[model samples]
Target: MKSRHDMIERYIGLMSGTSLDGVDAVLLEMDAQGKPQVVEDSFLPFPAGVREQVLQLQAIGHNELDLAARLANTLARIYADVVAQLLGKAALPAAAIRAIGCHGQTIRHAPHAAYTLQIGNHALLAELTGIDVIGDFRSRDVAAGGHGAPLVPAFHQDVFASDTENRVILNIGGISNLTRLHRSLPVIGFDCGPGNMLLDAWCQRHTGKPYDANGDWAASGRLHQSLLQQMMADDYFQLAPPKSTGRDLFDLNWLEQQLAAWPALDAADVQHTLLQLTAHSIAGEVRRHCPQTQSMHVCGGGAHNAALMQALQQQLPDIRICSTAELGLPVHQVEAAAFAWLAWRFCHRLPANLPEVTGAAGLRVLGALYPA
Candidate 1:
């Protein structure tokens, strides 16, 4: 007979971040103590057409309702396919997993409006996968007077907190965010600013690539001081914590507006400046709020960018910076694993949002379930 700790409980987590790149799915196994380990992982990239459609839906567009609903259905199908692949890789039936925590594609995130929307129909996902699906993880927090963004800090505290060393978990997806984990202080996190969002947009427009691989294009150009300063002057950077932003503020249109003043600037230089902007914005927040953070473990697509990583180290010479891989979790797996943990919390009826981090009136159990 196996002890309670030896019994394996499984959950699936699905995440398609603001990057508009793809969905990451993971099969996670939890122990009796609620500790989770990644047993299997899979990724499904969005086709260029689907990626374009999602980006188009970010702003108000033609036939809004029909387009959104149709795209939601499409996303659900993609999500179901990912679940199928995960189950196949694990060689297990859907009945073996308790639920899937899906952080749907976030097209609009306006916390001040007291609403945030992430597409991908959970009911459809459940119907297709034969597993309970937990989604819409942000609305409850937003309804509770919180920024329903950066819901990963609570999960970060659970899995990445250090009792002996002050640590910060930095996730650089389409939008960069940081979670400070101090031994004595409550966990706090907020979006720092543009991560790969601007970089990828710029690279795609100039180089026709989705992103500047390893930030080599940026590394090739010199940083334009004036352009960098102009971009940094936005009011969003000066705002206090308990605040969050998305493409709602920092989109390609916003970047174009910034560049309207520098019509003749070189594309590589702009890319370099954008990379520095991400690094500086993130470093500024870490210095301002987590002054004592001794180590920062990075997780997300941005971690794989060598140029950006070097820039971060240069921004903070005293703090050690490394990838989450060093901590036993790969860069790309962190966010997906977070959703898995969030699903587990929801299933257990545990409050998964940190009021301190999201500025909710109080803790709230996030994510609504769609039973199969």
Candidate 2:
């Protein structure tokens, strides 16, 4: 048998975030030093009808269990397809990969209830892909009285942290979250607020496009300060660290309800204000928690929004801000890669969640494994 120190393992990570945009898959190799090297990756767009069904499930609906289960199976099939594509592109066999880490489609997250659900049939995925699968990464942390989110911060510290300067890794996915890494302080992370989720939903409703490409639509209009203030008043923003949020709190219905107070606002203005809400909320959290942050690195779809980036720059005029790509990981791949790293931690029986970050009972290894 090979000695453990000489062993190398490969993992595949699949992430379908709250953006409801698509699935991101990545293949990575972890060596003895616990460094991950990305081998290959791909993005598979969700089927249009499936995406609609997912969005609908986010709210109260009839037959939701049935709908969620059906969506889980569909997502498994999609994940399997993406895994196959990754294997072919990387020229690796199924047996060569140790396991797959999947962050399933999050339909409802109520960590305060000590329950958060992510649906994707990992057993089915393992069966179809002929590879072991590891999933349900959030529940254990939640069970231990943790928020069970912003889990990626642990991975961020390992891969992106700097020892000389304070840095913040901001992941602007459907919902934005940040990881605070300082040379002297312990790691801290929490959900900042809305990211591309609101912007994309508003863009689709008003312009029929899935998202505000390059944030052009938002840039074409002026910000509505009053409306922005109303949206920012959400209670989630005022909470301290050990927090996480999702579409359950910042969805289209919530936005519409907030807009009820300002009935005459233009659609473009609403989009612009939504953009500002994201920028301001994120910057506010950064200033409040990591005021000494020397720089900020962004990742996820929101980094592609030029106008949003510019707004963020304006909000944090003193701190340097840029994409995670500058640190060797592309904006889109950071989350997926984090899942891959989580799988590595699982296989090694290592603790993945930070007690300081998630308020878990203590540090614990997360995720359950389903063997091939």
Candidate 3:
């Protein structure tokens, strides 16, 4: 086994979000204070065939554990491959990697039914990489009566907290979530609403592109006011804090139902409405809870979409909008990097879940640990 300290205690964080585009691996080196410094980052594209298989599961009616295991094995192969490549990019040997923080593909997340499933075997990851792996991050929190989503915000507090300034670290990933961080309080977090998931899914279906680059496609089109209003009417938007959701609630089905009455609209118009919906839902939540979260620091792929960012800025005109990069973390690397920080807490038997955020019984170590 590699000596944890001898290995630099550098952790790798891997995330494959609902967008199902690729695997993102972030390398974080912790200082003596346990604060993380981003060492390196890389994303490995999911083979088109693999993505197709994953999406196809959305249509299947029957259940098959054997087939799911097959997918899991293949996925772990790519996951470990991604971890290896990211470490290589950092010019570090695998032996020096202390542990990996992996958020596996979330196929279904329904806390209402007391269940959420994320596939990618931690044991397989440990066996493949010969490094201790920390994953299945959401399950422990769920079992403890938390939403089991937005776990990244706990890590965000550790990395982004400021003593003199209050910060709202809004992560516009597949699902939009915000961490309202105050100087002297535990970070508050919850899933805000749709992020890239809807926009990307819509674009892929209509144009074959994986996502709307900079939301330019949406910018070229006009928002259908009625459709936009109806999309915002989802009950999920009105749910209080301590809640989370997945594609199950805002899937293509939900969009189709809302748009069915107006099938006469142009594809571009539909695209425009989807983008507006994401920005609108998130903006409303910020205004409702953290009215004084005037300094908003955004991180994730959605932060790079110029049109969406512009829309958000207009909604909160009095607030400051900036990317996490401006705060020393890259937009693309924040979520994965948060997991890296979470693993650091896990290794020390420290609590990572925020009860104020996840409604857990209390703070607890949030992931299962695997030995190197």
Candidate 4:
């Protein structure tokens, strides 16, 4: 570990996951050996109106092109504001930061259709922040016949790979994804299924809270086993590797349709079942693909949910499950840190996407740069 006195290049990473809650900005410093150290981080939730607008645009609609463009600009302004705040907190000027790796809000991820859309006006961000910006890190992988997601597995391998033991890095954001790091086998990863998206949406619909704090609401309810079985019957779980999914497949409408089959169920019971759905789907994927995984380190907002964590541990009794904090990076900071690492990789022209995980044509240096 470098002392506070060590001078290192700083990079900024901005991420807004599918939960549509907010943007997370992380300022990271990388040493000569390519290890990343977090300098400072910030989280800014979206305004109520902006979050509603984003939710509306998640599907096909009238005048979507115009709305998307406007939303992108709005999101860019928010991102720029976050950049300013991060720089201010770090006591560093914009010039001190080499570049910002911005994972623009993913509006659509349809790799099967050979395209994915992540919208944030990088040009505007660069102009506003007075710093270089790298965005659209997934399009190249999609163009190369890949899922264009779970992209952080490469970063996980770089930072969390262990020679002494097999490991799996699980990121439970709006969507849950896992990366398998074997001591000998090739790294494997993919989207497991819904993470906090369904649970949060349900909580918002029933309790008016943004999410189940520590999953207390979910803990208060009883798990409806029948409902969970029906939910697990979804084909997404049984699909083979090289697969990915997003709000398009697992959104409010989808849940409503599933709930329709089992009428007269309590809302809290439904919330409890949704939580179990997330745990079961994720555990099932790990068992099928990386059964030999010795340890699992979870990250993202879902990691803070004590009930969800307990459910995951119950589902995978043999594997040691814990938050990424044990490994150094905090749960909420891992995704942002990965994007910062991506910016560092882009600066060095290093390949950031792993073909095995994304099913891309080959290793590729992801993202496009917009100079300030």
Give the best candidate by lDDT.
1
Model 1 lDDT-worst window of ten: 1-10
In model 2, state the lDDT of residue 290: 93
Instruction: Provide the lowest-lDDT 10-residue window in model 4.
Output: 1-10
Model 1, residue 240: distance off in Å is: 0.8
RMSD of 2: 1.4
TM-scores, all candidates, are 0.98, 0.98, 0.95, 0.97
Model 4 stretches astray by more than 4 angstroms: 1-7
The predicted structure with the larger lDDT, 1 or 2, is 1
TM-score of 1: 0.98
lDDT of each: 0.93, 0.92, 0.85, 0.91
Candidate 2 per-residue lDDT, tens place, 286-341, comes to 88999788899999999999999999999999999999989999988899999999
Residue-wise C-alpha lDDT for candidate 4, range 1-372, written one tens digit per residue? 776547577899999999888999999999877879997999988976988888888889999999999999999999999889888898999999999999999888889899999999999999999999999999988888888988899889988999898899999989999999998789988999999999999999988999999998898889888889988999998898878899989999999999997788999889989999999999999889886888999999999999999999999999999888898889989999999999999999999998888899998889999999
| Model with the higher TM-score, candidate 1 or 4 | 1
lDDT of 4: 0.91
- By the lDDT metric, which is better: model 3 or model 4? 4
Error of 2 at 165 (Å): 1.4
